[model samples]
Target chain A: MIDSIKYKIQICCGTMCYIMGGAELHLLNDHLPSNLKDKVSIEGIPCIGKCDTKEKHHPCVKINGEELNNATSQKIVKQLLTLENNDLL
Target chain B: MTYYNNAVITKHELLVRLIQLLDTNKLLDDIDRIPLEMRPRTNSPIRCCVHKDRAVIKYKLMALLGFNIADEQHELTPLKEYAEQALEGYTQNGNFLTVVDEACSSCVQVNYTVSNLCQGCEGRPCQVNCPKDAIMVLNGKANIDHQKCVNCGICQKACPFHAIAYLPVPCEESCPVKAIRKNADGIEEIDFDKCIHCGKCMTACPFGAISEKSQILNLFNNIKHKKEKTVAMVAPAILSQFKASSAQILNSIKAVGFDEVMEVAEGANMTTDHETNELLERLNSGATFMTTSCCPSYIEFSEKHAPELKPFISDTPSPMAYTAMLAKKRFPEHKAVFIGPCLAKRTEVYQNQNIDYVITTEELGAVFAALKFDLVKTDDSPIVSKVVRPESRGYAASGGVTNAIKTILSSEHNITTELIDGIDKKSIRLLRSLPNKKVTDASFYEVMACDGGCINGPVNVSPLKVSQNKLKKAIQEIQSEEAAV
Candidate 1:
């Protein structure tokens, strides 16, 4: 079996997101399945430097490539489902 | 974007970067260039210019390195100098909280302003309720003369349309003990004697002027000295934090150079058992009511705001203290560093001879990142399961202490428990009211300054609900694993 997951998820660990919801999102590392774990490279970035831009709702996350503002644990988990269920990786 | 992202995360990322540099032995050469490189001249300015932003970052790095700004005067010395001073083994002071005076917004201290929403009504109740006659209607709107205003706040109540608003300085309004007040220069200063070190103001400040003095460099230096084994005492609240299993977290901690990870919950089990016995003895011995002193901030509150209740507080050392004592006892050659989500734990450990250091979950997260330990790829927490009872594990949440005490105290004792989930002005007042010598009907009061206890502590990087769920799952897994035996 071979698994090559190329997802690079960067969650904003910036203070605004930290205070708003980024702190909660840091827990994302503990929830993903082990199979998906090998594929996804998750990191808490200093910040994407986009906080408060366009009055953005924070605890933002970049999944694969697209940034999702106002992200929650459930939303992130849902996005990870596809990557996790795949055994082919 | 708001400066908050830059204000808060910039400091943390910078600290992590410093640690990463140190891990790679590049600290001395590359550290100074961090702010400069991050805010390069070509980049649009965060402040008036990149140079100004870099200047603020320098003072911030100083604080992060556990040194206060050379105090209200003298141009800042270079980051290299502070790094040298830290390496020269300047021990940290008891004053753990410090304010960057330059960052202070020096916001005007005023209360109950009449806004444009103020209806220029003929009734003029704002004027009528103003005892100082501070209110005057002009330009078809109510205006408050700041000099004449006593801040009585009567006009706020008098306004029918709620046009009058109360503007509170973030740091001043959030301090439960009123320890922070502005100096003549308008920069906020903390009265250390009154300050509880709860760190509410740290999160409340928009300017991020408030900061905890760092001890990470000191810890690394301690490890460098090789005086003793570096024992990591993991708090009960830490089990499910950061989405890492207890095994992974423990191994990751070991991966960071800790000789071993001792469950603070093991000490908590002892604490819970000992505290319960103390409560039963106190209640049976005809004490009217006893308070749990496990929370250092609660102890500070009792000593400062409610000295009358000092006699009622249990003399038992807190879980952190007890764990440090136990850790020291078990391994005489060990230097215990408590890892928890509490900021007050810093103040608590500074006085404790047994505890060598106090690092928060946020700080530990930085260290983990600096070392680049990926829990997703690492093994689960290498902890021996069932080493701690499930009840003691409940120490992470509010009411957990009372529940643990209740498990030990017989129902025949007829103990009435009062649980205070959060401490604020109102709760402090309520605590003060207990000493009236009036007809009282309580055996124990469990007070957690932070709502949801240590899980919701000031510096915990995880969400409470998520942490709680993980805690619940971990406890169940422990119980079931034992059942499998």
Candidate 2:
């Protein structure tokens, strides 16, 4: 069996999020470090209801459940870099 | 219960069984979401264009065992290598124009909003209220000058008779943008400049007049050449349509020509994880009320009518978009087509660089018919699995969002979450009527614009009311199974 878990990033694909640029949310796959490309999984979602709170602040996404704001490919890459560094640490 | 052993069941056979179970109630629900008035009575599975915007299609094909497969996008494996193929050999129009005619007669107007303004002024309130001075006195009645009148309904409101009416344009009314208009011939005309390609109007039109230029012939030619593998990502609501378990649905889709079948629901499960984290952070950082941007129509509405709310839209990919990434990751060599009950998905797929094509249930049926292949009668010798995450299955209905959030928060801190679906003025009124402002009470809220969830999408094969009941049954069945397990 193939190990489904590796280096993967999941994104919410809910309609609300897609309109906020969720449709192209996984464009970040291009920005992944070449060494980690095979391990990375960028995905979308329907609705998680996280941003559905009374006070919604977004362009919101998560990497392994760690929240990131002003999410873009570049910002996500940096977060991954820190995770890689922490694994060594 | 028509029970077929999983080991012997082909995906097509499974699908045939499912389709037979889909009666008028289910068909009505599907038609309601798709906004289809008159669909074809094809000998095989039926497919047709849902006239809302830019001619997006809805398809319901007979799958293995008489199951119904409804998809917004078709399998795109055949279209990957258009450069090397002869397009003429494979091109065939299913008398596309004829399908549109049958639909026009039965198309009923869906009143999203009605004219509340009756220009109550004495000097023909429509003329007095006309901002452009476009109204003229013709035969002592208000007549709008075509050149100067901007189609703004101020005159309609000003008229006491409420005689000045905003007649529903068969094709252009459902457009997310004000892109569609009438030409000199009274036929619908699309303005590319303002068109966002949402395809809502394609599903809205009664005449089946608005349609997308065909890329099917090119796709068929590519398949003949065999350039890439086609993978189809089906939406969660579709799972309810199948009489058998989810695994059988996967097998049927595979039988339809998909190399691999994956659930878009997994994306829903993952989104819950991503969005919840985002919510916690945003709340800590100090932001006021936030609205969901998941529904494409709502998002487009905010962009055109409520741009101020853009910042509030949570940045998350739709389940389909998320699943597309997973498919690409798992099978990098394959081109993906999303199959579901949504016309907006056509525009969403076109706009997204990752996805290849979006064919509705109607288009899928057309493709199956074109091949003279009956998915229901196909041999049932395919591998299938029954495993689906509870969260994944829960993503099908309107309140599925709330359930996922609730499950996630069950073990966590005490954050209050409230789910709101079928959001309209009435729902807003209920929220406002609360004693101490209910909107502030919940840590999270899920709102779906449609009265029923996506099962009633503009491209589904079931009715909203029946789908709602089915949704309840499916959910309860799942819950009881979980409890028993």
Candidate 3:
């Protein structure tokens, strides 16, 4: 049986993140591959405070509670697919 | 950052770094390390090599320090020296833009090229339609002769196979007034006399070759030294720039060490009254039509490109001008800073002395990033002014000005308006021809240099659709609150 649990994707919508490209990440749902469309859920949350880190990973995203740095829509989709493929193993 | 291209992200990062250095008081000591730090040996170079990228960054830093690249006296002058000069109150020499020749890609002059897909067909439509006789069929393939080609693009359209491609220099193509062009070295040069400071070319350049001299350091120095009580005159467009509420944004401006915050929408209300009276006077005097005089870029366009329409431009002060005047009256000794989404506003501030400094919404964002001000968590407070009308807040959008005036004049006078949504080559031609046209259908004209208005200004961070929806919601909320009151 395929793992049917939906992966929670939290996108930072803070001012810094919004300006630094988080605005485009909101459209990740439309760009996601058909297979992963039902496998993930996306939510825009207030600043996760990760952008203030020493590395300044702006437009940060959290996928299934794991932090992703400099997250783009494509990067998020790729990460989601990778996660799903690993779950199959 | 994906919303903006790579170049804009780099520019913003550079700004954030510069502001951080300024805040830490390590600007002069560590300024030279920025270029090296940003492009280290480990990182792949964006240009020919790491050294070239460093050179471009150095010149960009010079521009950010409020000096034109032309002001560089020698090759050995370090970035530290420029920082020192900037700290010592080096004012810009009235030029708003500087082109870093090092960053310029030096695009080819030839515009039209025949692709391999060309069939060299029997029809020879390209050769037949060439107005300048610039197309010649050699070796059974159509070729564009650069020497004779006038770039009219007639041949490209006539090609049946779409084999002809028109290559454009983005900056040159985007400029509405033809202010930016390649010089003898093929590097883009801005002609200040022709420049309206609209900043379309700045946004169009993918290489980020064009730099606007920032007054961020100057404003920072003033705030740091406590030279005077600094007052921020926030534009209405700023309401939708971030995900936070309008009240939170204003409160955050206060949290950024601004002693006071004044909404420019208050002045927009003033502008509505004054401009409406001016329009009424013009119509009573048998004037054909009058145009709104709020957009600084449009004003510059009229003075330089469309001189014939000068008589029709209203003489009333802009919202910024009115706000600055009010600030002067309210707090005579306060340093007034106009925070808005405009490059032309810098030039406007320069001409209008009441406004001590001007910074774009992007620069303000950089300041927030440098100070680590989380606007989402900022405390909300009541807006500074209660007199701001719903129509005044609408001034941030394209037809907002006309709509505001229409609300007042529609009852008494039959007012028709023409909105020049954004200034482009096509809109410019229409604006130029307006004076010569005998028939006038519109009584009032609303012209905004940026498409969709100030919310979509070149320096604005948020996307158009997002900002528009947010602005619409904010305006509606304000409308309901006013109705309840």
Candidate 4:
């Protein structure tokens, strides 16, 4: 059943995350390998409120409760590909 | 100017009256009657329509002045030119069209639904619950008949499909300023008088119905001046939006030709320091209570609806104004451009001589896209250790200013403080009622018109709820060292 499949992609649409261009993160869905898109559900939440440092590193999104600090579309795609292959390569 | 008092008309009521008057008078048809000023080659109908609307407004103003539009003339300037110029002058003078729209939207749309749904049961839940008996159930469901409905949306919240729907002009509905309104024809009109030129309506309108006049080409032409120094002061809220590290963001801004990247958060620090002192001074002087003067919209509301409340306004400049002033002082010859999620700052730039231009976050995004800045691709490390107070950064959220002020008061003295954020027009009345002379729990007041504060400012890109959270987290993350600054 489609309902049985539990694939999660957490999207951060928080103010800070958005300033980090989180609104544009939705565009990453197109880059996903089609199989993952259906299995995945993306939800935009208010700020996860992490990355309190001034190092230009925060306003991040969490995928499956694991925080992804460098959350660019490219980094996100690579992370997804790794998830799909089930290999560290 | 002879000012007549009429129960101190709320800005919102004035807006409704203006809209009702236009509808009653069929002003839209007359707006269509005025001709475009452009010779032979005509401008777009939309552009001409705006001019025509201006003409009619001018005619009305003239009538108010007892100078007939047809009769007023001089040798060098024709009546048409005079009218257009006068309308333009009127716009330049205090109009607060956006505030009127906001008040109108909060009142009219809400009043309509409340009026319809109101069931005049013997035991009225709405009336009983209303802190102020602003609601009266006339027929069957709760009818929010005018002079009663405070546009609190409390009744709507209390009601069982979110039935209380407030409608205003599309731009007005969308505008953070509440500047746009509908004429008799259902066409949207701007109160250039009240517009701070934040351009939120331009993005909010699905129909592309509202727009700001483009100064891009003018900017490009001015860019030819090799000796001219152009500086872009970015808001701290932008830290979360860009792809690069903080330092890289600065570098990227430099790459875009800005001489230096200064954080508006620094200005926030200055404002916090000054505002704290001002609040303390007010308390010490026995000035029963005071309200923050940071948000331009809040300031505008006080000017219109509660002029008596003006004495309570803090004299401290807003972060944007403070930052621009400092920037102008640092690089006296440089042109300063402030970029943020505020539509009202456009008016700030014109009103204050320290700044040259104001661009919204969306406009800044466009600038990035146009420049083809591959932000994600860049590996530049961002400058991470910029010192700004955590409390100051929290100023991005609603009631944030009050919280920051309260923190200062608590740290320095034993005086009590009270904070009210995310309050609309109705709540202001409640707050006004709470102010007592002798003894009160809260001595200081912090109220933001928009719920969730500046981050949720009408011009912001992120949703209000989301922005509020992000700001909360951001504040949590602020280092104690940084918070001190």
Candidate 5:
């Protein structure tokens, strides 16, 4: 069951994002609960170009292609929990 | 690790906006709109009101424009006038720091206050511990007498109820030299003679009241006008700053309008060689001990606070100084810019003739944001050098200097070394006491003002642990590549 379900988490490694708190989001793996450990895969991607938009939220993250702005470790984990709950149902 | 608080975010936002305006040649025309734009009427106020918030932003922009708040000739002077003056080469009088009085929270004087939890207990330790008899039992609670209290913090510790609270001004507490204090208006003021420009106060202020005068606009103006060939001499600490590789970051900096990029680590090699010789010479000549003079803030501290230690400071030039010299010899017509995570370097540049400007790592991030350079996607521009030592690259972390010198002097002599990781009140006292102590154990002393060295500098972007891990990995990779060759 763990092998069948995997969530994709792409953390922005852009300069603006990295400085604005994206760097800490890279440590989301360490922060994941035991239940969600094998349920998610994290990768760092280059700038997603959201910094130039009218709504300026930096250090962005994308979980399963859903954009998360002003990303933090706890916020990402909370989103992951919801995603995992929906997928299990 | 530095906290990404709202103050830091606002500072970066202002920098990016100002640089963006300068890029499109609309800075002078739209400079005044920045305060209003950042604090529109619709948005809730960050301070007391929108007007106060806008006023603070305006003063912060003035500092970003390289003008001190004290430089304003009139109350209604627009930011565009400051921008105009900056473009016209108005000198900043070598002052790198300024206080945004509008933003200053005017924190109350540092003192101990007895909270309601104070029980006026049977032990009465608070009354007993008062050196000045400042503590008294009022009704059923303990009270501190403001008139007699010296703020020694004895009663705060003696209270069994743990009710006494010590309130401190963060900036004053962070300063090593006691350089900043509350003025008559309660706003903080820095004594230039006492300040070594370590920038601790700038980082410690929760309100972001202290600001460094930025040279970003002046640099942008030069690059845009093609006034002179601009060469960026990046410090070794930069390798740990970004997530991308060193080559990619260098290329990205080139993309930011620098004509040439030179690694200051190359100059660190020169420092190692000269310092090794100086240490050997001093040791052989029967001198007690010698300290490394690489840290600009440490050097300034020795000059202003510890004058007697001057004779023991090594005469070897810092990596920045050597790199700027090499830059001048190679690019005779270029204006050399030393890019690093240091505020004291601005003061260092004022004394050194070869270097023309200094920019912190935070300002560099703003430049990248304004230009919208994708760092990882940028083309790799590897440094072209005959010999690049891994030891020189290690100079970004604490004890790296001693390790480099040890590698060279290991076989010849068994020299003892001591490391002063960071400068603070306790470290200052130790440093001052060093001269009086006889028969010291160490022959070499390495002093870094910022704990964990330049990678953990006040203006650094990345976390200290992240930087340390990255730097270790990068150095190991360099060692392996050298081994393969």
Candidate 6:
């Protein structure tokens, strides 16, 4: 149902992101739902520099255009699942 | 059980980053800043603080450089200088695995604790049953004095409300041989004598305190400085690890500067040829059966725990050693580099005459990532193929050895088979009771230390299903392709 929204999950591979477990999210490429493959794209971007700003989110992974704090394996997968299940795929 | 653990991922991430620096020839100057640069300037760190996280990373970097954590460095030495020293032919000694003391969580030692549910009754069975008077009632609650407590657990049983609960350290629980134990400081220590190097504790530690010393930098130095060509002996278990077809994996391995790629499954084919003949010889002579000794950890386990089964273990060399020997036979001056799943393979390299170095599938992934080479994206340019037989290719899974043996078994004298998937306390007990087993006439035994065989090995980074699919595809591709060599 939410297929119209183009989603891009940007994993921060910056120095800060790597420390906050951003490098670990590289495994997400394997865990992503195949059906949702058409809806989302995964890419590793160098620190968006948002982490060094006043926002204070270091391990943030971007889903669509939204930033997620504490973007660990569990949280990121949960967020992805919600997006997939919301579309009811 | 699921192998996806946070600590394990964190450990691998560190290794990959260290390797990236080494791959680019930037490690000498940039190695010191890696831990600091990765340390977060803002937000939260996984440890207590960014400093603490960096401290752990420092030790991890040391391990990636191939130094045991227990080794003492000079007070005036920089890590870069130490790296230079290591490259200058510093001989390594001490344990295979190391504990970064600063990173250890130092959990409490008490296994059993008295909960608040104790009613403080007049007939305090917990107090009464305490042989050493370790338990006492106070303020309508029960408390155990750890000083007096010998950990007999009589009080735990006597408690009426089931208030006493037992807590175990994860690494200790995961270890089959009870090799990992807490020292006086509560930091886990591995008794090198007792360790089988299965690498369960390395993945089980929540703090990422325990790690195997890496062969990456050493491997890099070997390839860069050595006059001899470096040949990669890729394991059968590696079938599940890479996303590329076997043909592509062959090219991808060469992409990393390897001179040759040898299929370890080809070695497995040889091993099967020998193992099958051995089994027939033994069974025909009225011997009960023989066990497959392809798994180095299984061989160690059988030698240490099941001494009686030592004679029964097939005397065949492992795929890694066998393949390396094959490579050496072809090229007299080539250095054999084994890439596979188990950490025990690292230790196995010590006894190996043909193999020069061994890296896990996890480590290979790190090297690939560091070098920015994607196995799946690599073009299928088949450089060399040994024409691996389909039966030996099946050795990646649990029953692969059984099937390989079945192919050659003479159907002589009603031979039977039993299987042990994973090594744990229960499996060890079963192994002990094998001779006395009355339920089944299972004379022949196949025991794999890691559940589901080498694909499910402790260091294999890929998830079970993903690896399995990739392995199947690679086998099919390899089967169809003809060997140019």
What tens-digit string does per-residue lDDT give for candidate 6 at B201-273?
A: 8777777778777666777666765655888888877766754567666777777788888888888888888
- Candidate 6 lDDT over residue span A1-89, tens digit each: 65553578887655344433454566676666666557667776645554432233656788887888768767877887887778775
Chain B TM-score for all candidates, comma-separated: 0.91, 0.59, 0.93, 0.60, 0.94, 0.90
**Which residue pairs clash within candidate 3?**
A20-B1, A21-B1
Docking class of 5: medium
Question: How would you encode candidate 1's per-residue C-alpha lDDT over B314-381 as one tens digit per residue?
Answer: 88888788878888888888888999888888878888999978888777776765665555456663
Q: Residue-wise lDDT of candidate 5 within B1-485, one digit each (tens)?
A: 34657787788889888888988999999989999888999999988899999999999988878777778899899888989888766585766888888899998664788888877788899999899998788798888887798888888888878898988788898999999988988899989989999999998888999998888888888987788799999998888888887778888888888899898988999999999999999989988889999999999999999998998899999999999999999999999999999999999999999998888888888888777878889886465463668888899999999999998986859789999998998888877877766766698999999999999998878778778977886677567767887
CA lDDT, every model vs. true structure: 0.76, 0.50, 0.85, 0.54, 0.86, 0.73
DockQ of 4: 0.06
Question: TM-score of predicted model 4?
Answer: 0.56
Ranking by lDDT: 5, 3, 1, 6, 4, 2
Task: Estimate TM-scores for all models.
Answer: 0.82, 0.52, 0.90, 0.56, 0.93, 0.83
lDDT of 4 by residue, B152-213 (tens): 76666665535566654445554544556665534566766555444445544533333333
As a whole number from 0 to 100, the lDDT of residue B180 in candidate 6 is 88
Quote the lDDT for B224 in model 4.
29
Q: Chain A only: list TM-scores of all candidates.
A: 0.72, 0.74, 0.87, 0.78, 0.86, 0.71
lDDT tens digits, residue span B156-232, model 2: 66666766666666455455456766545444556654554444555555434344433333343344345557777
Once fitted onto the true fold, the runs of candidate 1 whose alpha carbons sit more than 4 angstroms away are A1-22, A26-89, B1-7, B38-52, B70-73, B88-90, B114-129, B135-143, B157-163, B221-228, B384-386
Q: For model 6 chain B, give the 10-residue run with minimal summed lDDT.
A: B86-95
Model 4 chain B: ten consecutive residues of lowest lDDT: B1-10
lDDT of 6: 0.73
Q: Which number leads on DockQ? A: 5
Q: How good is the docking of model 4, by CAPRI class?
A: incorrect
Candidate 3 lDDT tens digits, B281-320: 9888888888899999999989888889999899999999
Candidate 6's C-alpha runs over 4 A off are A1-89, B41-45, B73-76, B88-95, B114-129, B138-140, B154-163, B225-227, B410-413, B435-440, B479-485
- Docking quality (DockQ) of candidate 5: 0.53
Residue B255 lDDT in model 4? 70
